[model samples]
Target: MTAFFFALVASFLAATGARDQLLVAGLRARLGPAPGLLVVALASAVATAFLASWFGAQLSQGMSRDASTMFVALAMLLAAFECIWPNRTPRPQEPTRSLGAIAIVLFLRQLTDASRFLVAAFAVALASPTLAGLGGAIGGGAAVAIGWAAGDALESKVPLRKLRLGLGLILAVLAVWVGLTARGLIG
Candidate 1:
């Protein structure tokens, strides 16, 4: 349960990264106002959670504790790098005139988000499969909701450069924390 909770929290924070917000907005604009969008989002969230849980379990079970810690540390470091060195040029906005197209875009965007993988893997490593799935569903769903709400606000209020720097720092800190915890340097 504790592992599930941590996964949930970490996933939420990671998902809320600025790049994801842009993708979701792009998806929403393309999809327009469609009821199917909700369904797609929910389905995507559940499927992602399930997959993540399974993978995380495999990783946790197969790897030594040191290996697991190293993997996570490396992932975190890479994430930090991406966050810090984001593409500076803004993507050309595409006009999404249909709901169906928007749904597809959103789904694809989410599929590529690192948080989905991290959350699922973390959940699996931290707890039983059932717990990991449940945690992922809850965390991913909440993250989508939060992203939807904050996407526009963040775009308007926060500078992308600043957001990236902050996220990079946070991810780095998390990597250190996870490494220490895994090594039993922290309780």
Candidate 2:
């Protein structure tokens, strides 16, 4: 349980740090204020936790070290690509910024975030299905809240370039960590 808890927390932190900047940027651009940003962030966390927990359990049942490593690598590479070659087109304007729309946007954003999946996988592996679900929800919710607060506060203060660099570094580190774990370098 202790090990699982540590892994869950570590993985969550890693994933959140890796994607925070991009998430914040999107929120800032789309929503444009601290309150709206918070709503989106909270919605994202809840949606991610639910989705991750549901999928993580299914994946964990048949997951292997090699497969996990490959998945992680692919995710890292994809994240790198997104950071280096982001789609510059402005987000499609939504006709209505309703609560439902906000929910959909938040859920979609989290669904695309690889770190959430990684954390879910870790949680599922470390604990039973029930625990995995709970852990994912808790972790995802906390991460989203934290990311939202940080993003809202630092949106104007920090430069995008620096955020990208930091995200890239974190993704690289996570990729290495996943590789090492797959190779049995770490337990």
Candidate 3:
């Protein structure tokens, strides 16, 4: 249950205005909120989270609790850094408007996203990959669903870069705290 909640909240925060959300929202704005697109996005989120959680489970098999906790903190630090980094991927020309293409793109984006990283970290810390994966899937799905539902309004209404920066800073602080606690340097 703790794993589920941690992954859910972490994934949701990490996914806000992320590349995947931007992709879904852009598609919705350009093509309308197609149900097929939403389905594909949800599928991609679930698949990516599950794969990450599985990888975390494998890693946790050999680590002590303290080591797993430290690893989770490291993961959080990585996520924070990722959020702070400037995005340089130029928007590609839409080669096709097919659902399969969209699915592939979304899945690929999630493969390196902060949400998946947090899901994996939580799974390692909690030793509950299934719960972590389910939570991450739901959280990621909700973020994309909002993008689909809001379309251009989401981009126009929200200061996404600011939000990302704020979240990144918070994650960085938490990571430092967690790392210190795991090392018995702080309570």
Candidate 4:
């Protein structure tokens, strides 16, 4: 039980990297200080968590612990590469439309996110996919809230280039940690 919750928190921290912080910041800039940002972020979190958990459960069914750990470690490694790589440039100027834009962006980004995979893998370990999914949704939503607040406070003062680099470093650390754990170096 404790481990399950720990994974939820870990997933939140890992998922709420610079990429998401910048994304929320961009969404805020586009929407112009609307209250609906939180709604969309939370909604997207719930939807993404549900899907990710289900997928993880399906994938890990009948898998051994070592295999599952390897799967998660590899995922973290991939995420490290994603974060380290340069981010995509913003598209041409387009007027903001509705909350759907925010939801879509959040959902798409989270579709194969490390956090979702972590939550799903945790669910497989705990044999409680629904609980893991719920916890992941809350954690993901909290991450968004944190990102929104940070973005709002730092807007225009900090360079996103630096933020992106920092996120890559964080993911690299996480990947190392996961790799070590897989190799029996960490508990």
Candidate 5:
């Protein structure tokens, strides 16, 4: 059950990742549906999910269920906050920010994603972080592929505000659910 929810949310959030849209849109414009770009994006997703999940699994060591639940709840809250807050500017780029290659950029971008945190939390919660990562990798790949396919009309057609609101609401609910389960209020 945890894995299912983790994968569903991970895929949705990853596909709709705010940072990724601009890059994808830019690539679409610059490359015109180039296969190489899509391949890179897919590979990046796999690598990103693998690393994120493994890190989460390691963090889960010695963590009690209640503690894990608390952490997940906190992460979900953070993700909700991200959705509620208006987008902010990136800090002035250190030279480290100027990496080349779409694949590498995409992989690096996942490092700081709220979506990855959710995957990590879910993995720890279910005691299946690596499995959760596998699901996340699949979801991430699918999201990028679908979003890239629709990149051309994404701006005019996609209702981002509504989508964010909906996803945020779901995350909020999950936070509550985790809290309840932690407190022994739910199964």
Candidate 6:
């Protein structure tokens, strides 16, 4: 389906250099490859994507097509800003190495990340929350799996900050164009 493929690609692109993916990669670097940890990451991503898509579906029930488009554009703008912003939160000293703690942290990060927002927006736009959610889950899961497999190599070999900045700028431009079209200012 169009919705599925679109969300899959968008979520995958959005997940690059995301905080959740970075955190998992960092943990893998420190702890070595752990299948259990990858499972946790996948579960968290799936849950976040599903929740967001569901919320988007609910939101779409009451909104007009233009309103949904406008809202999706706004979400894209927020994600762009997040990607462009420097992460200022200092890494906290780990009080515990529990998998539960890791899962909680990963879940929280994914809940607020760009990919989830995109998943939600796509769900609203496409009117197919289930497909959008599944696509987003798979894409986001793949990103986390890559992080797990690559370990420290990801950080060393890739320019994550630069990649994210580029993504941010692209998303911002797309958002503006979408917003303008939604407002009938341009098509």
The residue ranges of model 5 lying beyond 4 angstroms of the native Cα positions read 1-5, 87-99, 180-187
* Model 2 lDDT at residue 154: 48
Worst 10 residues of 3 by lDDT: 87-96
lDDT of 3 by residue, 7-72 (tens): 998898899889998888888888876899899999999999999999999999999989999999
Ranking by TM-score: 6, 3, 5, 4, 1, 2
TM-score of each: 0.73, 0.61, 0.95, 0.75, 0.80, 0.95
* lDDT of every model, 2 decimals: 0.63, 0.56, 0.90, 0.69, 0.69, 0.88
lDDT of 6 by residue, 70-122 (tens): 99999899889888987665444452467899899999989988898899999
Query: What would the per-residue lDDT of candidate 1 be over residues 83-140, giving only the tens digit for each residue?
Result: 6766554543765555467556556655645565566456445547667667767777
Looking at candidate 2, the ten consecutive residues that score lowest on lDDT are 86-95
lDDT of 5 by residue, 1-187 (tens): 5685666566557457455554665566555777777777778877777777787788789889798888788778766665555445342223122224666777776656656667777777788877788887877777777657876566568776567667778778888887888888999
- Candidate order by lDDT, decreasing, is 3, 6, 4, 5, 1, 2
- Residue 45's lDDT in candidate 2: 67
RMSD of 3: 1.3
* TM-score of structure candidate 1: 0.73
Among the numbered candidates, top lDDT falls to 3
> lDDT tens digits, residues 1-187, model 2?
5424643564355345434434544565555555766666666665676566566567666777577565655556555444444335443454244656756766776675644555555545553545554555566666666555564454456554565556666766766777677777896
The per-prediction tally of clashing pairs is 3, 0, 0, 0, 0, 0
True-vs-predicted CA distance for residue 82, candidate 5, Å: 2.8
Candidate 4 lowest-lDDT run of ten: 89-98
* Count of backbone collisions within predicted model 4: 0
